[model samples]
Target: MSSSIISDATSKVKNMVAGEKGRKVADLDSVSQTVSPDDRITSDFGVKMGNVDEWLRVANEKKTGPMLLEDSFSRERIHRFDHERIPERVVHARGAGAFGNFRLFESIEDLTTAGVLTDTSRETPVFVRFSTVQGSRGSADTVRDVRGFAVKFYTQEGNWDIVGNNIPVFFIQDSIKFPDIIHAVKPEPHNEVPQAQSAHNNFWDFVFMHTEATHMFMWTMSDRAIPRSYRMMQGFGVNTFVLVNQKGERHFVKFHWTPELGVHSFVWDEALKLAGQDPDFHRKDLYEAIDNGAFPKWKFGIQVIPESKEHDFEFDILDATKIWPEDLVPVRYIGELELNKNVDEYFPQTEQVAFCTSHMVPGIAHSDDPLLQGRSFSYFDTQLSRLGINWQELPINKPVCPVMNFNRDGQGRHTITKGQVNYWPNRFEARPPATAQEGAYPEPPFNIQGIKARTKSDKFREHYNQAQLFFNSLSEPEKNHLAAAFSFELDHCEDPIVYERMSQRLADIDLGLAQTVAEMVGGTKPEKQTRANHGKKASKISQVEFAPAKPTIASRRIAIIIADGFDNTAYSTVKATIKAASALPFTIGPRRSEVFPAGASKKPGNGVQPDHHLEGMRSTMFDAIFVPGGAESIKTLAKSGRALHWLREAFGHLKAIGGTGEAVELFKLAFALPDLRVSATDEAIESYGVVTLSKVSPESLRESITIAKEGVGFLEKFLYQISQHKNFDRELAGLNSQVAY
Candidate 1:
């Protein structure tokens, strides 16, 4: 909330680059060119000034004893800085965005009259912005954070943005403590050291004490927190909304977006390294995926609960931090979204597209989830201060639909009314807007009669049940990731009290998880605590169950590492097969380019374009890797310890591996693996995604093709598992029985 936090505007990237390249914005030539805090201009009272000329600046060395208190310059500068920041959003501040389009699969007029959902024949242009809560805009992207999934569908009816997050629930049920939760989660005011992270004393102190945050914390610690790619994460509208049919029937609904590619996350170690290697990993990945023509897509669906049965379930539908289990309320697939393009500008489009919870059309309405209520008011109000009073008139925020109103404009107005009579009076016939029935936006009236009084809903008090459910839902690997995440974050906190309290919070969620975290962080568990509400039942809210309806190798990338002395016979065959399977096959070697044999000499330029140089690339950068066989090529690969380690790392991550001819022996040597010999039979090929023949005959090329197809096949079979994250159960079981133990 203080100006100090936001004022530390000098970015790591900005400081590391730019000056070396002569000061073009967004350059990374050298670190010294970074903007230094001391070199920046400051106000007379010592505050770092954002604008030098705007303030009353001293013209000479002589201090003119405070001149006329009416000096316009001083007053204007201070006045502007006085309101420099609107309230940093109540939640979800740091974010990234993209431009795209949403295509309808089938008309849903039978369910609702909303044009975007019902207009199956049209393609609606769209803008999507993803964000992280708690951190300021300058924070890193890979922290154990909940992502905001706010999509603005610029439809003919109007812009409909299902403002949501990757998580289905929030930290609390009621809106009253929204500010309290955010404040506690934000960097400590006395000294804001931990930026973009939530393992501090204040955050854990809040979670352990309140207990309502248990469910959310579990998610924050799991693999979901460290997504491998934004393309592989699912999105959920955290609050319930209403869909009205043409018959005036209202159906309570929640929006769901299941990634077509599947859910995936990086190991914690890789994620942490990425924070330093590339804090913009997510934003860049999203942009690159689109740029590469591998457009990211998510299947759009809605879970509709009939209003007549609003009280059918024991839990109140209006609770913000609770979810309606998929088994109970199955999601009906309605459409799909494909992000085919990236934005050309960041400031005007991606940065300024405001998503308001109250931006609803005639057929869609709001639910009274208290947090939803607070957001509807907060988003609009904050935009006014952040962008001028007429923020909607800004290009990015303005509605694409036609606009006509009797209301006059304010600061930054771009429109001019022709009529002299600005006030709507009878004398001026048809002078202004009237009657809500004439396609003039109208809100359905729901009668209310009550003596106004502040009250808390009882349903909100039963918080820990869902939290318990979320913890119990994680698989062993997922649980390990969660526990490891807890230890990693808490270990960073200076205060032992922070770790001690947070350790107990984990224990309360799952004893095993708590015990593991305690061991890792060297912290003692607190005295046993009761559930936030013991009698509450566990619910279904986990990623383990979210899988694609039909699994395919579609856009998954398979990197084939090749080099000189590679067998052209085996190489030619694998390339053809990978292309046929529809998965991209990128050849990588020690050099940027490799050639086929120039008259049987292991050499350059026979006929292949190397996509990457192995030393400069890492296995973590690709989905899977393959080695094609040649005696000399395998020998070259074996010598590069880095290339060998790439295979071992990929195997440890359970990624699919492929090989043929002598390359199979190279893979064995790379991992120090024992011999795994087999003839080029269909069964052997089917099992390991590897194929080999005694020697290269024309038939061997056919066999190599089979090997590549097998790798593609293996990817297809395990795509669901890859998306669900890793196999933690297999990992834990292996660890327990390990002689390494």
Candidate 2:
């Protein structure tokens, strides 16, 4: 080729690349059409329509006759409506998605040459879908099941997907058993009695039969399964992948996403109550957080292991049921992800968004992990079945980069290629594949030594070690919760064989845990160990260890209960303080109508209106509750059983509780605990996660709201308690159990 011709071609390619760098959002906007009141109704083919609400009937206004089938507009509307529902996902069906950007804070050029990971200047667009694994599209969000944390990165190279889960491991080691595990955990095939619940006979029976599921089932039973919110959970790739550097040096990598808000979960009772009170709790929480400008963020990290030392660990690195303990392989955080925008529409954007584990850019490749290899094929196949052959052309799933290939048309094909031929090696040498030097995906050569057989490695046989490690690693309160979870699940299993086997199975991790669950579920109490406890522990396995470096109340929901005679000064000051701290404050009264505060007129405009009535919302909806002092307000609350239940339920759930002045007397009456202390003078008393000020004044309330280990002021102490996600001390001291919530 001539110099000038070559120069022009290179310049054109550079311009195209530059234009596609940050065009993901713009590309979607081009295909998106907004509805307006000024626009008229139109047919499927863009023809103007006058009457869409009524069908074309061959009759007068007085009498109706048979509808005319010749009306193309009516037929088209009916046909579209009839075929509107597409196939929902077989798993991870209940989900919420948001658009965001991934920014690399540190480059890992030496580990991998993938531009998205090695390029620090690029702000790669990302769409993340948070989901519950076993539920249908209509199921509740707070079920005790694994959460799907899938992310799609629209990088300049192409679209890369990290289809992961909140847990770091799987229920089974091999993909062949994927269907079996999911089938057992899902609603039973015969009755379909349980919806989005694992507390059943089949699940326990399956786990007992296949000991490999022990570790993952432990995670489900722990608080991890019922996360407080999608924004507060960790995401793990759960499968081992490979990264090849420029030198062709291969390394095994595991992906991690640590949330900035810290890991937290609802108490089992609270989760159960919220599932009925608000089935869309988690979905709405994600939307509300982003809409209120409190965008959720996570730090992206990777744990890399050289191929030469893959067998350095006792457990198989590629085993889907095991975790590469962070104590051994510390995560190297290199990037950050933030969800700043919600989807414009639910059907086209969130529902139609698909993910495949096979999607990858240059310098990244799948490992020989048995489960991962199967997922690469299964995910793509599932998408094809759900969204047709040309699913990739969907607006939400399309890549921003130029895609030039000889692939022809299929169902729902959107691209219109203008050319004489769609074949490679044509007479014009058109659209040839790129060379290695031009960013082509490199395939690292490896030797195959094993025979083709259906067998697992010896390391896969050792399953109980890690399960014991996880149980031993948890905090005391977490251990108690896990035990309670096991007991509850076993109790739900009507089959005696199922619960009895599971009870003995717990002995492999801890004898005390086995005995506790066995006694609670009417199983023969295990007196001796089934398998000796390994007595080993790993760090960062407990959610408590994932607490944020600094305390914060941002995005926390606080409820302010009041009546006709509530203290205006205390209420106003606390509400303003909560908003200033970037936390949400909701007013709750007997009714949604305006309620007169102390000395305020009983007029519509003069009184304060509550965000919700006591009967409309429960204490399960808020993270904390505050009651300001007023003689009449306190008396009204004391007389109402619902209001008393609110205080007790918050206390039983170990949530932060605050009260001032006469409110302290109401708390004492509601709790009725002689051991518990309340302030009597202008002092703040914080006891068992409850903060109260018996006397309130402007001078006392003027103190700064800085959180301290031993908070001096009332607001400081209350806010400090709120910052701590939960107070396990109350549960440990047996104070929460005493409450009759």
Lowest lDDT 10-mer window, candidate 2?
A: 16-25
Q: What lDDT score goes with residue 299 in model 2?
A: 97
Q: What TM-score does candidate 2 reach?
A: 0.97
TM-score of each: 0.79, 0.97
Candidate 2 lDDT over 1-741, as tens digits, reads: 676765665566466546656465578657777788998888879899998888988998799999998999999988999999999999999999999999999999998999999999999999999999888999999989899999999888889999999999999889998889889989998988798889899988999999999899999899999999999999999999999999999999999999998999999999999999999999999999999999999999999999999999999999999999999999999999999999889988899999999999998999989999889889999988889999988989998887778788889999887656678776445656899998888887888798889997899999899999999999999999999999888999999999888888888889999999999998988889979887889999999999888888889999999999999899999999998888899999999999889888787798898999999999999999999999999999999999999999999999999999899999998898877889999988989889999889897675358766676889999999998979899999898899999
Candidate 1 regions with alpha-carbon error over 4 angstroms: 1-94, 105-111, 134-138, 406-411, 434-437, 449-451, 525-541, 579-582, 593-609, 673-741
Highest-TM-score candidate: 2
Error of 2 at 186 (Å): 1.4
